[model samples]
Target: MAEAELPDPPSQGIIGYLKMVGPGVILGSLAIGSGEWILFPALVVKYGPYLLWAALLSAIIQAVVAVESLKYTIYCGQPIHKAYQRLPPNPMTWAWIWTLLIIIPVVWPGWAMSSATALAALQLGRLPGPQDSYLVLAWGLFALTVGLLVIHVGRKIQRTLEIVSWPLLILLLATIIVGVAFSASPSAWATVLSGFAGFLRPRLGFPPRDQINWFIVSAAIAYIPAGFGFNLFMSSYARDKGWGMGSKIGYISGLIGGRKVELKTEEMPFNVDDPENLRRWRGWLKVARLDSYLFFSGLTMITLILTTVMTYSLLVPRGLAPTGFKVAAAQAKALSEVLGGLAWIIVLLGGFWVLFDNQWGLMDSVGRTVADNFWFASERIKRWAKNDPRRIYYLTVYLIYGVAVIIMVLSTVFKIARPYELAATGAVLGLFALMIAPILQLIVSNRILPKPLRPGIVSNIIMIIGAVFYGFLITAMCLQMFAGITI
Candidate 1:
């Protein structure tokens, strides 16, 4: 791809605005998957919506981080990790360490396992147990295969993500909204409204030991929308979409034999010497923020609100707490109660889509991140992925699904919650990245980006808030890990 081949600037007005919104939908759809559907609601059912504050605060803070990260690709056609590789004092070390810590957990098979459990319960009465390992493994592999195939069929990763994501997003919202209307009572609606008010002032507190679980759940809430590591993937996705200077670098091709495109391992910073280029850059930046705030952050917030509220109305009242395979069946049953028996099927279908989407999004994003990071880290690593990242990408996908299948089999054999544990562990690690990513972004943006493109006071302020907010959670989580402080 040449510089002149950059995506044409949008036409003026709302139509132009709508066109700029495509990339954000991919982000939003990825954001609203298992974490919003499974983790957030699960937590809400157990502890109510007082912690809704975590989701609200995390979305805004992560939005700031996400925008800052996007600036790299928008202006320079470089993903955030490339910027991180430019960090002082052993950038390669930082790249490798954070890569393993962040990507492994997020892409782990727990999500596929969770979704399969739900599918199994919907088909049977419950998850596959000691006597049913074959069923769990088959269903788990099926879900993983479907998601992988969906992405493999399309030519461009961005287009594929958008195509798959749009229907899944629409289906989920429609099913949930209709379910809410049919089942949620007048009082249930009122409680949801009041829950928003209650979020402002946390009226309830956990006991000393339970704080560990509280922090664990809070970490998942903060990360469900945008984790520290996933933010980088968002930048990669934008780059692939030809958002700004990113257009200069072409996209990844589909799994089938298509035109093979490869990004040069070297960095190609956007030349902003001319004032006209700067003007166009600013326009692209506005488009980026619009998508980041309204679509990526905004849509995620709306979805979380509905899922949490539904859990409160249906599961909390009935004293149901979703764990392991029960998350899918229990939530589906709650929807069935409101929308009738047929609605259970809808919920199950939605759950399966969300889970499959979640797995697909994680596998693709994390795999791309690792491949990109390797490709940029050193020339030797670049050739290791065969100079064509699609190889590394598919390899990573296979490895992730393979591991997840093992987790499913183990869980079935032992009747344990291994997938959930891996997911929760990943969430905690991802949140730790969330705490550090903004601080890194703040430093990188000021150091690398030109004065005109750097973040302003308002963005910096939000980044600070994000750092402090995520920092506190990380501190508590660390203390819990080391000091054996339960809470």
Candidate 2:
């Protein structure tokens, strides 16, 4: 591999490590929303934590994938999408397919609409009623608007994320811990521990007749923290934050009309053969790994276990499952039930922040992914948008707003499906990216990246395992859609 320019080594020390922690925190904050607050709890309440193994397994698999994907961005200062576009045979085609798979399913308006449901439930005694129809729409619209505005108000995207994510992440985790502590019993602890131990011997056990269809539901939940497109977007966040090689490419502007910039020659890839450069690269890798486990996987596992335990202790005994529009509200009420009205305030405040952040973070990621893909796929996009990241970024954001608003309006008017159900279904669809992302990330990491910079054999093996696991779920989902097989 020819030598290219490289960025300075990541800062070494407590402050330096702290600065590198934004992306994972942002991802963790988003993960705490629908999946933790609603789906995991609802499923555990009905299924008795029997499938806790899936959550444990999924987090490990995703962490492996996340590290490998970050390698691409850290090495080349480019997101995986651009690197995936360099794949053999038909890079553009592969990029197109994955881009669509990641963006479309995720934009299903489930999170925004679900936030509205919880807000309505808070204001009224139940989910949105006929008289509260306008208020519900306002709630959903408000979330979308705030999310869009937050990103636009600032010029540096990374700074904005750091300011918002860290505080919210801490608050969200504390609430879940407190909520679970107040609600748990010895038996509930037993169920959680047993299910976690079940990780050694995973099974699809007989599908539940009365509770959630764990077979399909767990697949969706697995995609929350690090699976689905969430893992892939981490590369962008890292690159934009100027970590390692990402510093070369710089970052996109957060404002809609921020000044335009172009990549400089020094920001390009560096020669792996250079010993000093290689040592610096290794240093940055350590930083990335630390952030991955500490904030990304660590917080994710903590929140998932607590929420499951809390709900298991509270709802499983009564055979109650939170469903439909009241999903978030139900979780809050569960805590309130055990610890009284104060718990409701705690849970509700935490739940609202999480749901709102989830929607906001996702919209930013989806917009960035699409905009980045288009920027790489065609010179026409570059010319049309004048190579300005802000223009393309806002264009995609507006596009997402349109799709989300349409789904929100239809779901409100028709009442065909509940908000939480719609959100979970969208998550299920998002598993499509998980199936393909590992393969693409693996290919790019090995083929496009220099040999010494490539992932180790162990990393490669796990990527395959991750692919196969998601493939099995995707196949099962396909079979159910076509052949009516349950499990």
The candidate maximizing TM-score is 2
Q: Indicate which candidate wins on lDDT.
A: 2
* lDDT at position 195, candidate 1: 49
Candidate 1 deviation (Cα RMSD): 2.9
Candidate 2 local lDDT, 121-146, one digit each (tens): 67775556667766877899998888
- In each prediction, how many residue pairs overlap at the backbone (N, C-alpha, C within less than 3 A)? 4, 1
Clashing pairs in 2: 4-271
Model 2, TM vs. native: 0.93
User: Lowest-lDDT window of 10 residues in candidate 1?
Assistant: 202-211
Query: Could you tell me which residue pairs clash in candidate 1?
Result: 183-338, 211-487, 212-486, 212-487
Q: How accurate is candidate 2 locally (lDDT)?
A: 0.73
Over 4 Å off, model 1: 1-8, 125-133, 195-212, 271-273, 324-327, 416-418
Error of 2 at 262 (Å): 1.5
Q: What is the C-alpha RMSD of each candidate to the true structure, in Å?
A: 2.9, 2.5
What TM-score against the true fold does each predicted structure earn?
0.90, 0.93
